[model samples]
Target: MKQFLILAIIVLSIAQIVARPVEYSDGNDDVLAPEPEPTEIPIGKYLLFTTKANWIEATKQCRSKNMKLISILSEEDNDNVVKVIKAAGEGRIGFWTSGNRRKTNGVYFWGNEKKITYTNWEAGKPDNVRSNNGEEEQCIEIMGLNILKWNYRFCSNELYFICEEPHESIDETQPISLLFAQQILTVQMFGYYENNENEEVLTPEPEPEPLYDLVKKYHIFTTRVSWADAMRHCQSEGLQLVNILSKEDNDNVIQAIKDANQGEIGFWTSGSRTNNNGTYVWGNGQPLTFTDWENGVPDNLHAHTGYGQEECIELKGYHILKWNDHLCSYRLYYICEENTKQNLFSK
Candidate 1:
């Protein structure tokens, strides 16, 4: 009977041991369990999504949610995005941003088509490394393990992503009274008057007469055309090739180009050496008073080499927006300028 009881006890002990749950460990002191996938982790005005997807699918998902992939426009934006990812416990997983150079390699822009002015790329990054299949790394991802710096990556790589609510949507959520007060404040700031009925009335500001009694309007044509063809097209439109005679004029022309959002490589300006004197003048016979030339530009290399005269000037070099001389036959986008007479009868 003593041997039987001892054997039964041993059997019970073995059964209990076998039934006990097995703890999992991967050579670590602390045991870890599979974590649930995170979804819609919100931080500040952005949302972090942990579900993995390729760049194209990620963009589609964000759009389906009525949001856009986040655009890190500044250092603060970068920091906030990193914080959101870290807080979600996915700091080791890269997240896709809205920046990509798919349209024009080496020229990154946000989904909204605005040029990315600020960047925090890792060393030797954005090298545009090609895959074995010859696919280029055109999309940007915030490296989760590398101090949250940006790196160009293959667009088809599955990864987590972040999204940002548009400012217009936020504004729509504001209380009506608050929006009304903001409108009143804007009216007051713009020099409005309160009538006897206590209603605000916006008083029109006196319009200052434009210089030379004419208002200059700038236009950008995205169609690639030769310098002479561009000049002829502008003339056909009752305008002239642009004459950027002042810094203000140059700035205005740049703004116009940006507004067009046509992603042009360069624009033909009305600058060329009409006479053998070697001085550049506008097609409209205006002397070149202000010049924003890129360093070592207007070199006229082709002309000197007897290929063709590089007399026609263009606003080339993306973001540099500087002037360079190219052969007249080379096709490029162009800008046109129109002058309108000021309305003398208008109050």
Candidate 2:
């Protein structure tokens, strides 16, 4: 009887072993790995700007430094400016602002038509006292007080100012293209409330510091690739083709693309030969010197010729099909190159 009980116990043990799935472990390795380095924003620096520049020189100063002149669009920003100034010393006071009345003396204007209607002006000031400083003191400036009220100064006077640093904010939540780094959505909600929907961007503004650590060089496509494929190739190299802005802007970009493509490639462009009204013009604001379109290319099937979508422009030659789309995505091998020109800030 005891032997039978022992046999029964052995049978139950075997059943349990068969029922439970085994989880083997070497006792050292972890299942999950750490995130990639680029995914980590190192504790390097915060993107912010604070200036103590006096009025006149500040404009050129920000420009030289590749920054927009400081814009005090909110109380928080105002406080930040004040803190920077106070941290410096008692002597440091006013800095250049986006305001100007030089063009129309006595009339006020913010650098981008930002309404100063909700501004914090000192009592009984902007009185147009007509100071004997010289010409009509057209530019605007900001000077501060120990209290909330700050004084407005002339723009021509020299002062130091602050520039905000750029921050990389990737919305991992969004479906937007992940091709490029995402900048913060700098919605000027408060600035808009004060009728300041725009910054002084129409006028040429200063550029920001280099985003990448160094001027990463890339090869222009020696063989033409479609725009989609070109984008993928650039992604592999960590760069993109030169997006030309004007006729002169094409010079350096084209030179770089040519060097990379080895005279056998083309590029896609952001423009078409035909405009909305059907005028065929170079995206770089110049008339074409040559044409090479498979002989009968530009079929213009849609017939929306003037600035039409089908009317695309490509760099003809060397088998490289660098092309741009009427829809910003028509595939082609147009231009391929990379550059890092400093002092060229984005507006």
* Highest TM-score model number: 1
Question: Which candidate leads the pack in lDDT?
Answer: 1
Count clashing residue pairs per candidate: 0, 52
Model 1 CA lDDT for position 134:
42
Q: What are the per-residue Cα lDDT tens digits for candidate 1 across 24-115?
A: 56778587655444577887788888889877667668767778888788898888888778777777888999787633224466755455
lDDT of 2 by residue, 1-347 (tens): 99999999999999998987555445546643433323111122211223344443344454555444545667876676556555544224455565554232134544434435446666775654333322234444555444434455544344544444322332212111100111111111121112276543223123312212113243555455554565567657766543444343455555666555444544564245445566554433434433334445566644464543566555544644433233334444545445553221232
Native-referenced Cα lDDT, model 2? 0.44
The ten-residue window of minimal lDDT in model 2 covers: 174-183
Task: List the pairs of residues colliding in candidate 1.
Answer: none
**Cα misplacement distance, residue 211 of candidate 1 (Å):** 45
Which residues of candidate 1, in runs, are more than 4 Å off? 1-37, 168-347
TM-score of 1: 0.39
User: How displaced is residue 233 in candidate 2, in Å?
Assistant: 66
Q: In model 1, which range of ten residues has the least summed lDDT? A: 176-185
Local error of candidate 1 at 84, Å?
Answer: 1.4
State every prediction's TM-score relative to the real structure: 0.39, 0.30
